[model samples]
Target: MPRRCATRNDLMKPGYVYIMTNKNNTTLYVGVTSDLERRVKEHKSKKDPKSFTARYNLNKLVYHEAHQMIGDAIAREKQLKAGNRAKKMALIESINPEWQDLIIGDE
Candidate 1:
C-alpha cells in the first residue's frame, strides 16, 4: 500500500445553507457557506459592522442544511430568499419549532 496525498479537488467541502435570526426573531437571513461554523462565528462577531446581519442583530443560527457542493447550497439559498416569510418560518419551524439558536446548542 502507498500513502496518498490529498489534492484541492480531494478536499471538496460540503456547502451549507443556513438561516439566522435576531433574539426577538423579528428578522430573518438566509445565507450559504462552505464553513458553517466559521460563517456563524463571523455573524456573531459582526465581521462587517454595516452588513445586514450585523444591522439586524441576526446572529443566532436557527436552521441549516448541508449539500454536496457550493453550487447546490447557493441554489438553495436563493430559493429560500425568494420565499415568503411565512414559508421560511414554516421551513425553520419544521426542524426548529422553538426557533432556537442552533450554534449555541440551546434547545
Candidate 2:
C-alpha cells in the first residue's frame, strides 16, 4: 500500500448550517449556505433589507457546522428551524457558550 496525499479538489465540497442571532440573543435564524462567509456578510450588510433576518437584526453568527453534502446541510437547517428555542439555544451553547459572533474573519 502507498500513502496518498489529499488535494484541494479531492476534498469534499463543504456546505454549512449556521445560526445567526440578534445582539441580545433575543432572536435566532438558521440557514444553510455553500459559502458561509458570503452569506454571513450578506446578513450583516442587510443585503435584503426587507428580509426577516434584516428586520430582526439577526447578523451575529453564533454557531455553525460543516457538512460534506448540501442536502445534509439543508436538512440540518430545517431541523434547527423546526426545533424550539431551548433546543436551539442548547445547540449554540454546546459550541459557543458565550454566543460569540463566529463570522468574524470568516470573510
Candidate 3:
C-alpha cells in the first residue's frame, strides 16, 4: 500500500508523500498519495467508510512530498514508515523543523 501528496502541480499524481501529526504533535504518521489535500480532508472529516485515521483522530497535516511516479513515492514512504519514531522525527526535522502542517495551502 502507498500514498500521495499535494505539492502544487503534483497534487493529483502518484509518487507524492505526506506526514500527519496529532493534536499534541507527538504522534506522527507518514503517508504518500496522489491527492494529498483530498485525502487529508477525508481523514479530517472521517469521510472514508473505514479508516485508520478516523479511528485515531490523526487528521492534522504535518508534512508532504510530491512525485512524478507512484513507485518512487511508495519506496520512500515504505522506508520512512518502516523506521522508528526517532527516524521519522529526524526526517521531518531535516525538512520541516517548525513542524507546521504544510497542508495549510489548501485550507
Candidate 4:
C-alpha cells in the first residue's frame, strides 16, 4: 500500500508542558507531551511504578502550558527542570494558586 502524506491538521497538533506534583507539593515533575490528557492519565495510574513521578506520588496536574510546536514544549520542560524549586513554584502559582488538579472534572 502507498504511504499517506501528511496533512496540515496532522502537522498542527499542539504540544504541552505540564507540571505534576505530590499532594504536599514537595515534589515537582515537569514533562512534555503531544497528548497531555493521555500522559497525565498514565502518570495518575502509576503506569510505570518505578518512574520518579510515580515513586514520588506526583500525580497532581498543577500547571500546564500549550505550545504550537513539540520542540518548544520540550525546551520549556527542560528549562523548568533545570530551574530551582522556587522558580517552578512561582510559575505554578501564577496559574494555579491552589494547585488544583486540572484533570479533576475530565473523568
Candidate 5:
C-alpha cells in the first residue's frame, strides 16, 4: 500500500503509472513518470527506435493509475514491476479482459 501524503486533495500533476503488453501478450512493461501523454505517444510511435518497449511492440496503454505525486506513482510502478508475469496479466485482464489498448481512457 502507498503511504498517504500528509496533504490531501492531491492535484493531477500529469504523472502516470502505466503498464504495457507485447503484441502477443506474452510480455509486460510497468512504468511511471510525469508526462503520460508524451510518453505514451512515444511508445505508440516507436519513437525511441530501439527501446525495450518499442522492440517488443509494447505500446498498448492497457492499465494506468494516475497520481498527484511522482513519488507515489513511482512506488506503485515498482511494485507492479516486481510482480510475476501472471500477476501482471491478471491485473490488466481484470480491467481489460480483451486487452483493449485504452490510451488515456480516451475510449
Candidate 6:
C-alpha cells in the first residue's frame, strides 16, 4: 500500500512553540515541544552540552505560543527560524519589551 500524507487535522497532539535567548538577549533559539515546561527545564539544565541552546546559554524563555496540534507548533517554529533576526527580535519585543524570561523562578 502507498503511504499517505498526514493532514493538519491528523496531527492533534497539543504542543508549544517557544523562543529562548541568552541572559544578554544576544542570541535566539526557536523550538517546538509537546511539553514546554519539561523542555525548558532540559535547556536550563543543559541536558545536551553540545546543543545550540546549551552552547549559547539560551535558557531564558523570552516568548512562547501554544497550538492545538504539535504539527502546527512545528510549522510555526520553522517559520520563526527561517525569519531574520530583526523579525524575531520584533516579535519578542511585542510580547516582552525587556526580553525578560517568561519562565522565571524555575531556576
Candidate number that wins on lDDT, 3 or 4 = 4
How far off is residue 47 in model 5, in Å? 1.3
Which stretch of 10 consecutive residues in model 6 shows the poorest summed lDDT? 3-12
Better of 4 and 5 by TM-score: 4
How well does model 2 score by local distance difference test? 0.87
Per TM-score, the best of the predicted structures is 6
lDDT of 1 by residue, 1-107 (tens): 69676456634657899999999999999999889998999989988999999999998999999999777787899999999999999999999999999897322
Candidate 6 Cα outliers beyond 4 Å, as residue runs: 1-10
lDDT of each: 0.89, 0.87, 0.75, 0.88, 0.79, 0.91
Question: Weakest 10 consecutive residues, lDDT, candidate 2?
Answer: 5-14
Order of quality (TM-score): 6, 1, 4, 2, 5, 3
Tens digits of lDDT, candidate 2, 22-96: 999999889988799999999998989999899999989999999997777877889888899999999999999
**What are the per-residue Cα lDDT tens digits for candidate 4 across 1-66?**
696864666556778999999999999999988899999999998889999988999989999999
Q: lDDT per residue, candidate 5, 9-98, as tens digits?
A: 343354689888766777788988678877888888887878999889887888887887776887788888888988888888898999
What TM-score against the true fold does each predicted structure earn? Answer: 0.85, 0.84, 0.76, 0.84, 0.78, 0.87
- Per residue, candidate 6 scores C-alpha lDDT tens digits across 8-101 of 6667879999999998889889999889999999999998999999999988999999999999898999999999999999999999999888
- Could you tell me the TM-score of candidate 4? 0.84
Best by lDDT: 6
Off by over 4 Å in 4: 1-13, 105-107
Model 3: runs farther than 4 Å from truth? 1-13, 105-107
Query: Model 6's lDDT to the true fold?
Result: 0.91
- lDDT of the structure predicted as candidate 3: 0.75
Error of 5 at 41 (Å): 0.7
Worst 10 residues of 4 by lDDT: 5-14
